[model samples]
Target: MLIDRYNSQLLMVDVQERLAPAIADIAGVEAQIAILLRTAREMAVPVIISEQYRKGLGGTLPSLAGLMPGVQPIEKMEFSCFANADLQAALSGNPGNATILCGIEAHVCVLQTALEMRAAGRLVFVVADAVGSRRPESRSVALDRMRMAGIDVVTTEMVLFEWLRSAAAPEFKPVSQLIR
Candidate 1:
């Protein structure tokens, strides 16, 4: 199913400083996440970010935090954001829409979150190119697992275009320039 910008929300899960460096292809993941963040802002899709044990992992990376000024992440110790009251509360306001996930450790936090979100009956879409793990195999396995669990595994470009729907969209020219 195509993502509906009006009903969908973006969840940036545990893209922290210390943890981020350990992720394989960290640069690639960050670049895609930047695109997702920009697209979400342009499309008016609400965003909720989560940090797993910030004290240990450090806060969200400076590059990402810089893009999200004035926005604070919901800090959680749980592997799945839904397990935290604050995180769940953050999502409560934007219920019934697809949840687009992009973050680190694809085999852990991102994987667990996607499964729980799917089990809750939320249409979940995990941006494949925007998530990574310390090992490539772990990421690959997790993506396959997410797909088998009924989550839509997509890419950043797919998401941007899907949100826009058509090139005639007013933001089309600027949004398309993001890929260049």
Candidate 2:
């Protein structure tokens, strides 16, 4: 089934400054994340970003931070954002019942969160193009695990087009500009 915008929420997990620098495909991951963030903003999709541990990892890199709204992130100590109290509640609070996840350390944080969301019966989609880890193998494994667990694997433009729905939709022009 196509993921509808009304039922979708964007989750940016642990895209921290200290960690992103160590990831192998930092450039590719960041580019997709920027597109994800900008699309979220233009499409009016609700977004929540988590910082794993502010003191060490620092906040999500400065560039992504600037694109997001002023919502203070749900600071999490747990690898999975689902394990954190504030993040869990805020994610549950969003009207979009389906969640789209993207972040760093794909094998760990992204994997666990996708599993948890599946247990909670939410329609979860992981944008494979938008997630990464320090090693290519871990990212590959995480995607395999999530797919095995029944999570849908999607991409940045896949989401942009899905969320946009129809060319005549009002958000089409603005969001298309982001992809362009």
Candidate 3:
């Protein structure tokens, strides 16, 4: 299914300062996420960010956090964002039913969150290139598991183009420039 800009929200899981360094190819993941964030902003897609144990993990990376000024990151002890009341409340408040996910530790937080969101009957899409774990193997397994469970695993470009739909879209040029 195409990701309609008006019907979807972006959920960035724990891509914290302390946690990011441990993820494999995190720089690449972060780059992809940056593209998504830029596209989401241009398309007016709502964004929800979660930080697991802010005290320990620090906060979202300064570079990434800068991209989202004025947006508060929800703090949670729960691996799955759905399990945290605050995050759940934030998500519930949004009108969008489809969620685009990206973050660290694909096998843990990202994976669990995707599964739970799917279970809740919401359309969930995990941006594969924007998610990672400490071990490539772990990330691979998590992607496989999520796919087996019917979650739509996608890439940043796929989402960008899908949301744009056509060159006639006002956001097409700006969003297309993001990937270049």
Candidate 1 residue 75 Cα shift, in angstroms, is: 0.3
Residue-level lDDT for 11 in candidate 2: 93
Write one digit per residue (lDDT tens) for candidate 1, span 90-171. Answer: 8767678889999988998999989988898888999999999999999999999999999999999999999999999988
Residue-level lDDT of model 2, residues 29-82, one tens digit each, is 998999998888877788989899899889888888888957567899898888
TM-scores for the candidates: 0.97, 0.96, 0.97
| Ranking of models by TM-score | 1, 3, 2
lDDT of each: 0.91, 0.88, 0.91
In candidate 3, where is summed lDDT lowest over 10 consecutive residues?
Answer: 88-97
Candidate 2 Cα misplacement greater than 4 A, ranges: 94-96
Show model 3 residue runs off by greater than 4 Å: 94-96
lDDT of 1: 0.91
- If both were scored by TM-score, which would come out higher, candidate 2 or candidate 3? 3
Stretches off by above 4 angstroms in model 1 are none
